[model samples]
Target: MEKYMKNLTYESVLPFSEQVSYLNGQVASKTIAQNEALSLTLFAFDKGEEISTHESEGDALVIALDGTGEVTIDGNKHVLHAGQSIVMPARHPHAVFASERFKMFLIVVFPKKGD
Candidate 1:
């Protein structure tokens, strides 16, 4: 099998664009291949857009591809900027806000088998 595939661009996945339910942004995610948990997304948000507060079911991570933002965890606020990334533990209440028009990626990973 090939080691990689063509990169996914936002314009290439136009039909899948969807709004972030809890926040005032949108996302476009694409599974790169079937064998890995890795994926990519193009997220867009209006300035001051905020997602609804919530928690995740499993370990997750996020990367700010292009923009400024903030994340709140358990009432604590932390600033996020382009090229920044963070890992979030399962079930922790968190919220994300776009201080300006923003774009990011969300990643969910499961433990490898027989670790």
Candidate 2:
């Protein structure tokens, strides 16, 4: 059997927020899964760190794991705290900012190869 996920412990109960660590003045990411159809990533952001506006080919879901973050979609900004989630639609311009040290889990679902 092939493992579909990586960088995670199997058969253990653990907090997802602890999977990644915040770096001083930097954004760090751990990729759990990656393929043509989906992507699963965990990110830790230091205060003031951000991902500039960009568009994704797939719909991306962001779930706050710790602290706080600001999500900007189509020019509108939203604040997310631990346990909160938001979806960014495919092809829409979006950005993420860390108002304070924060952690988040991101899941992106891409369309099938043939529509």
Candidate 3:
């Protein structure tokens, strides 16, 4: 068997909630394959939504695909407009809030470790 030719969409994934932090009615999807080193995800939030404070064990990158909002990371708040993104380092306190309806693509990188 071979890899590298698979396609994915949000509906193809399962739904899970995390207390780590997120706005009400938030939804997400992630894509992964065997031995995949990184995970790709899409997140959607309704207006006035937010993601609670939390830290990731792996590095995370978030790209805003639409809408506007403010993100507070490590006590700093920054505005995010369409086509903007931010990388949150591992173990850093971070959270997100949507001033309006919002959507984003997330990439979480996981380096392979020697057995």
What lDDT score belongs to each candidate, Candidate 1 first? 0.63, 0.97, 0.69
lDDT of 3 by residue, 17-91 (tens): 221223566644434332346666666777877788998766788888777867788989988887898988878
When summed lDDT is taken over every stretch of 10 residues in candidate 3, the lowest stretch is 14-23
lDDT of 2 by residue, 1-115 (tens): 7899999999999788999999999999999999999999999999999999999999999999999999999999999999999999999999999999989999999999888
Q: Estimate each model's TM-score.
A: 0.63, 0.97, 0.70
Return the TM-score for candidate 3, rounded to 2 decimals.
0.70
The local lDDT score (0 to 100) that residue 107 gets in candidate 1 is 68
Predicted model with the maximum TM-score: 2
Among all windows of ten consecutive residues in candidate 1, which has the lowest summed lDDT? Answer: 14-23
Off by over 4 Å in 3: 1-24, 28-36
Which model, 2 or 3, shows the larger lDDT?
2
Ranking by TM-score: 2, 3, 1
| Top candidate by lDDT | 2
* Cα lDDT tens digits for candidate 1, 1-115: 5455344444454332333222444533344333344434446667877776898655667777666878787778878788898876767898888888666667666556563
How many clashes does the backbone of model 2 have? Answer: 0
**Candidate 1 wrong stretches, greater than 4 Å:** 1-40, 111-115
In model 1, what lDDT does residue 37 have? 46
Each candidate: RMSD = 6.2, 0.7, 6.7
